[model samples]
Target: MTLPTITATRYVLPLREGGSLPGVVEGNDLGTYVIKFHGAGQGPKALVAEIIVGELFRRLGLRVPELKLIQLDPAIGKSEPDFEIQELLIRSAGLNLAVDFLPGSFGYDGSAGNPGDQAMARILWLDAFVANVDRSWRNTNLLVWHKNLWLIDHGAALYFHHSWMPAEKFATLPYDASDHVFSIATPDVPGVDAELAAAITPELLTEVIGLVPNEWLEDGDRERYLDYLTARLDKRSAWLPGGAR
Candidate 1:
């Protein structure tokens, strides 16, 4: 597949958690984008959350940003001031959101309200399976674009990494990865319906995944993401209604 390429010219400013990164695009090629890193010094599992579960969302049919990894030498960012694009999604306080654990209930509002329950239910199920505890309306993990809802920033999935496990233990997943609650052919959930799950596509998964930058997984973890996504597409995709069958 032909993935979009970008070059870093200037370092963007620091974002939430005080981690600074660069914002870049196809340098001189004409396009707008915001690039970010997993973290400082040693990378964190949050990067895994973004790549792994982000792709999962695509497979389950969700709108997400075209993301990628860009490399900005520490010298460039530390020496210069970079502008980071503020995420369009935000809480009532208007703070940037990070998915890792919802503080409380913060559902939808207006003619498009019930999203809180339906979407939240699906997300809760996904989190239980992947061990993701973050993401919720309160934290603004959900995005609003042209009156449509979208998922973003999955930096805290597969929380089991905190525990030490034998290789065999890792082989047999301890979580249930089912979408029965939000099937493409099940009862409706008030404002939302199972129809939404049907939107997932292999091409869309491939496409959004194409946005992940090499720098983000700079330490060979990129291969892990590629393999994780590919394997899930073949393995866990069945959890998605109309995913394979």
Candidate 2:
């Protein structure tokens, strides 16, 4: 399995754990990172939100936080909301500032408008397909470090809780799959502003895709993802229908 470059000895810190415990590592030179575990299930899942969805969004060219998986143990650190969260944060060999964020410039209510709607619509579609339900403002798990919208926490995707979801609950799944949302509530709601879209160069997409955790994708998924984005960027008419109007 693809894992972050970590040390034989690890240091886990005990911080207040809600969704994830903020942590620091000693080796590999990777700064702060979120951590998670293998095959984690809901209610009992090691980590909550911020796994596949976050990484996948990054692959699709959204700004997402740095992530990695680390060795786990209470001795390494205490106060684990769950092992999954602990593993992701601690294992990441990169800087972990995932602990902070403010809207405005991050991705919402900016002097312009939503940071990137057509792109976000794809994120929403991906989330819907994977069954992630924690992207709203209340949980905007995304962090805006250095004036960029970074996605965080996605251990909550891929419909793990379905094992217990009742027949009535399944209805939402069908509704979520619909494309009515692939656009926006109104056609005029310009997404992210033209300047931002104009600035999203292939180099930026490559850089963001490079950040995607290897473990999240099956081999070659990265190339396919990059290809998918190239196709999407080439076909902006589908994502940014408002622009056509």
State which candidate has the highest lDDT.
2
lDDT of 2 by residue, 34-77 (tens): 33434322322323235434555655567765555444433443
Off by over 4 Å in 1: 1-3, 17-29, 39-44, 81-112, 116-120, 162-164, 167-245
Task: Return model 1's CA RMSD, one decimal.
Answer: 9.4
TM-score of each: 0.52, 0.49
Judged by TM-score, which candidate is best?
A: 1
The global Cα lDDT (0 to 1) of model 1 is: 0.43
Give one clash count per candidate, in the order shown: 10, 27
lDDT of 1 by residue, 8-125 (tens): 4443334344243322322323434544344432244455456667766656656666544333344343444323332211001111112221223232333355454556555544
